[model samples]
Target: MLLDKDGILQDVIPPRPPLQSLDSLPGSLAQKVYASLKQAILSLAFRPGERMRKSEICEELGVSRSPVTEAMTRLASEGLVDIVPQAGTYVTRFSMAEIHEGAFLREALELAAIETVATSITEEQLVLLRRNLRIQEALVRDEDIAGFYEMDAQMHELILSFTGYRRLAFLAETSWVHVNRARRLNLPSPGRMQATLAEHKAIIAALEARDPHAAREATRHHLRQLIKFLEPLVHERPELFANH
Candidate 1:
């Protein structure tokens, strides 16, 4: 990893990592294609509004157009891509309206989950959360924003898991597709990753203290920060967003 004069990691993450190997992936051909494409899109490998040429994808995957189109169709259905009639397909852009709705849904689910967890979290679960935070701190120091994001997500899921409701995590994740894509775009901002780490620590502390009120407040603030961070991006990067 290269570092600048201040010893900060420079360009640590690529614009996109290499494409996923389909043969190594589990599932049917179409499913594998869909999974690969979705991973690329969510990870920002395929940026918003970027054209996805069928021929290029076919060449890259060494597959026919059928499966690629099939995968794209699936992505479009999920609002991850747009399928134009004659103009070829492009990744879906962000809109604050959609982002806010997704945030609202997530906060509603997570506030309740954290409240339940605060009252019932065991020592073992608390230890797991602390351990997760340690890794997140390390990732931040290393400037591994992608790794830190994964750990950040795990911390949330761990809280939901502690709630003893098997489906809440799935419900929160599946319902927040738009938010997830937009949320990641904000992580690379200077000092933002460290700020987020502090927020997570506050949440874990509230959980450790078994204070449901504190937990709810902490969770709410943490979730809202993503929206706050994203607000400026809409104007700065107008091409990456749309009213729809």
Candidate 2:
């Protein structure tokens, strides 16, 4: 059962859908399982700290224990799961420290990326960015919060891609796994989505103008918004967070 902010028992989490066949998927069985489980965890289908039973996962995915074990180990390494000896595996609880560290790294890498691309960004890239923004606007109008969040990530990634640094893009993707959880939790807040769209526009504008300083400031400002929005949530939903 899930617990509310007042620590009362709320509705139980429903069973997740069985994993589909991997025939058309691009990866190995283990990789596909890992991706599906990670998406479920990040999407909050598996609540924070909820136990993840291997037998159940094996049954759900129609796979053997080998691939499930491999997926769990990878998730554990990504800080998204905890495997305790003789106890069980569970979804990792939220950690403010980890979130902040992710934010810090994201700011550093993205700021550098934006600076590097400021003067050298091509028109095609600019068009791609604008197209992304237009899609985000439509998503916002439709109140498709989840779609908007995905697009938001894509927008930042487009900026980072201009740097031609594959490692930097990889780091940004990794760091966002932690930060994205916080954003998902806080997404229901009113006006947060609109605010994010405005912020993205600001950053894009600065980059288009070739003003690295403005772009850096805008990027820093956008990254910090998540922390500010999370302060009250951390207090209200203490059960969702870890002491670390």
Candidate 3:
């Protein structure tokens, strides 16, 4: 096998990368760095309230300071981090109110989209969704946390795509980054993982049946599960989140 100068495998049937809403991002230094860092944060690679040092990040990512700075700034603007004067940047903390707001907003918007697509879902879209669900189930069964999370993100994206609203999909994705950190925290529990998989199955069934109310209810139910999980975290660990 051919090897690059760094001596790592150039090609070894590269493993499929985990899923995230940022997967379809455009090509650019800023976008690349942003997606990378966003995924890291969502996957809990960077802990909540953890300080982010620009110099260290620059070296670690093998990129210049500008792109990393730009990425961090964008993340900060998204409420994923706090940049303070005379203090330093820190990963944003989780807040119960914000979590509730995110769930309510996502439920409203996504339910509307699901309703719109209930009758309009094409055969191809349904097929792809089935494939995604299969992958999601397999990942969950294997306890492949990263793969499960990725499939979950993609399933949401797929539903939005079927609604034929790129702008809505983009907005939905931006909203996901906030919830993702919380999800990463909550998902390690076996009970939570099992419930999540069950919820996904319920959603898939509702969508397949082309039942608008059922689809909407399924979506709302899943998000409510997250609310239950995050409320305690918010109360138990105020240090992990900013002012709510």
> Best candidate per lDDT, number?
1
**TM-score of candidate 2 against the unseen true structure:** 0.90
Considering summed lDDT, which 10 consecutive residues are worst modelled in model 1?
1-10
Q: Pairing residues by index, what is the TM-score of model 1?
A: 0.91
Clashes of each: 0, 0, 2
RMSD of each: 3.5, 3.3, 8.8
lDDT of 3 by residue, 1-244 (tens): 1123343333333332332333356689788888888877776667677788888777766679898889989988899888999998888878766776776677777989988888788878999989998998888778787788788889888998898877998787666657767876667654666788889888878888989889888888887887776676565556667773
lDDT measured at residue 217 in model 1 versus the true structure, 0 to 100: 96
The superposed Cα distance between candidate 2 and the true structure at residue 102, in angstroms, equals: 1.0
lDDT of each: 0.86, 0.84, 0.76
Off by over 4 Å in 3: 1-26
Q: Using Cα atoms with residue i matched to residue i, what is each candidate's TM-score against the true structure? A: 0.91, 0.90, 0.84
For candidate 3, list the clashing residue pairs, or say none. Answer: 19-150, 93-241
Assess candidate 1 and give its lDDT.
Answer: 0.86
Candidate 1, superposed: residue stretches over 4 Å from native: 1-16
Positional deviation of residue 228's Cα in model 2 after best superposition, in angstroms: 0.5
Which clashing pairs does model 1 show?
Answer: none
